[model samples]
Target: MAEEKQKKKGGCLKWGAIIIGVLILFGACAAAMTGGGEDTGDTSSDSNEAETTETATEESTEEETEEATEEVVEEESPDAGIGEQLDVGAMSYTVNEVTTASQVGPSAFPTTANETYVVIDLTVTNNGNEAVTVDSTYFKMIIDGATFDADSAASMSANQNENGEITNSFFLENLNPGSTMSGKIVFDVSQANADNPEKALQVQEGIFGTNSGTINLQ
Candidate 1:
């Protein structure tokens, strides 16, 4: 009877140890699964945040592009009209009259055009503190977006005096402040160009054509 009791006690103790070992293994597996689930959730959250940042960056870039395009459009707006003074760096230009003619000057000493002549009578006022030089080359007629130089030979003939001599006003003439110089600038352009709606005359403060502004035509 004593031996049987000892065997029974040893059997119960061994079974209890095995059951405890099984419970410990189950706890370890559950802990590992919980840790792995936490890591996966963290990775998913990081991926969502990265996606949101990328989307915001794309939207910001698009908005900046739109603003840049708007600024460019505003910069290309139309210029001023005729009879209005366009002020540049140190001078101001005003178109008094615009006429188209097949020829200029007196009939005996006429300066005929190849197609037609666009005569622009304008006034340039010196607004600077010092003096500035004016020349015929500083003016250009823009017709249908095409630029045409002033007809120098025709201009000399057109600006002849009552005695049939040159006036030399549109040449290399020096002007002081509060002084105005008026002359006719002739462009030997085609009739189509003279009658174009998108016409403008560009006047520059120097011979290099820098610091210029335009006067639009009808």
Candidate 2:
């Protein structure tokens, strides 16, 4: 009976040791699994945060670029007032008038003799804002399909002439704005040899031939 009791106590001790070892191993495994799960969750959260940051940065950059482009366009645009002034400069013209004729030379000459010369009076006004100076020599008269140079025309005064009819032949020199200049032209026209009254006094406006402006008899 003593030997059997001793054997039964030894068996109980072995069983207790095996149970303690199994419990210890199971606890270690559970802890390791939990730690691995936490690491995976942390890595996923970090990746999401990084992606969000990159998207925000790209959006900010695009907005900044758009704003900068708009600013540059505004700065480079021309002022409305300046643009209007430039338009006015391109369409400017001068005003001119032909004056009446006066008698020259001896007034008592024989009726048949061509002693009386006709004069033309011209007044030119500059309507532009710029200063202008015009030369009388550039002017000519077209009478009855015939062109009369300024040099050949007789003159009694700077702005008065003995010619019965005349027109502008040339436009020379710069005419300043808001200024007036006067000149006279003279011609010797016999009543019989005179050209058509209407066509005799034509004036040209520009420097180029056939491209000049014409003024009808007043």
Candidate 3:
């Protein structure tokens, strides 16, 4: 009976050891599974962070490109008239007299005996504060009923003769406020035309001083 009792105790002890080993193995497997799950979660979070950073960088680059394009368009646009604005003022002219005589020299006298000459004294006055320049090339002298060119009249006489139809060029560099300048114009008139000449000599539409003015040559 004692031997049988010993055998029963040994069998109970062996069963207890087997149960303990199974429990240890299950706990180890559970721990490994938990660690693997944690690693996967960390890797997923890192990937999401990288994607967000890339999206933000792309947005910033696109915004910069749009701003640069707008700046270039603004710089190339036209703004306003690119020239100096001229302010014109009032002008007046007066014809003093018309006469036949040479004041420059005797050598300038016309070689032709029938050719006569006349002088027209003009007084041009600027009433405005602005300076004015005139192109006197357009000036023409009218004697009797004939028109004479200004440049050709210069050859009539070497003397300063103010007779006949002639245009005079005077550079009144700057005609300040309320300033006046006097110049003489000579015209070549035939002796026959000068005889009993009703309107012996007259100046017409030869004075265009400025863009703005009622240029009266009377």
Candidate 4:
């Protein structure tokens, strides 16, 4: 009986040792798996954060670029919606009628390349106490950003037999204070510009080219 008891105790010890070994191996595998999971999770979190930061930076840059472009466009564009009342020096001027003609009277004056006549009927009142000379030099036309001087010969030819103290031409005239003179001023321009009156501009300068103001015909 003593021998059997001893044998049984020995068997118990062996089984205990086997169970302890199995437990140790299981714990080691679990630790390795947990460590690997932690590493993978950290790497994935870092990658996501980097992607988010990069996307935000790109969006901000694009917004800034768009805003800058808009500002540049605004600055480069010309002013629109002119052509109202204008006071230059001591003279107040008004452009009442504007017309375009392919031919002046029965004959067409000789012009350089693609030229056409533009007639503008204007009324000028001298507000100053002294007389002021209103001449062709006071008027200019801007087309497609290019300026053209008034054509005196063409204007004279257009209003050849027209009667009135103030002839139908942009004749050099002296106006006394409170007196108003109304006449037409003619200009020679390219047909390309005449075709697109939306791009035409009229500029008037007061005595000695002072107090200039612009009117947009378009």
CA lDDT of each candidate?
0.84, 0.49, 0.52, 0.70
Model 3 Cα displacement at 218 (Å)? 12
RMSD of each: 3.6, 17.6, 19.0, 8.5
* Least accurate 10 contiguous residues by lDDT in model 2: 79-88
Tens-digit lDDT track for model 4 on 1-218?
A: 99999999999999999999999999999999999999999999999999999999999999999999999975542332333455765767677767787656423333332367887767778899988777877787877678888887766665554332236355677788899877767787877777676644444445566456665665
lDDT by residue (tens digit), candidate 1, 119-164: 8888889999998888888888887667899998777677776578
TM match of model 1 to true structure: 0.77
RMSD of 2: 17.6
* Comparing 1 and 3 on lDDT, the stronger one: 1
Q: Candidates sorted by lDDT, descending order?
A: 1, 4, 3, 2
Backbone clashes in each candidate structure, one number apiece? 0, 16, 17, 0
Window of ten residues with lowest summed lDDT in model 4: 105-114
Candidates, ranked, TM-score: 1, 4, 3, 2
User: What TM-score, computed on C-alpha atoms, does each candidate reach?
Assistant: 0.77, 0.35, 0.37, 0.53
Best candidate according to TM-score:
1
lDDT of 3 by residue, 102-178 (tens): 33324445433336655555566667767765433434554445656543334333323445333233532345658
The candidate scoring highest on lDDT is 1
Query: Which ranges of candidate 4 are over 4 A from the true structure?
Result: 1-83, 106-114, 162-168, 198-207
Off by over 4 Å in 2: 1-3, 79-218
Cα lDDT tens digits, model 2, 130-202, are: 6644554544555666775543324522222235232342234465667555555555554433334543333
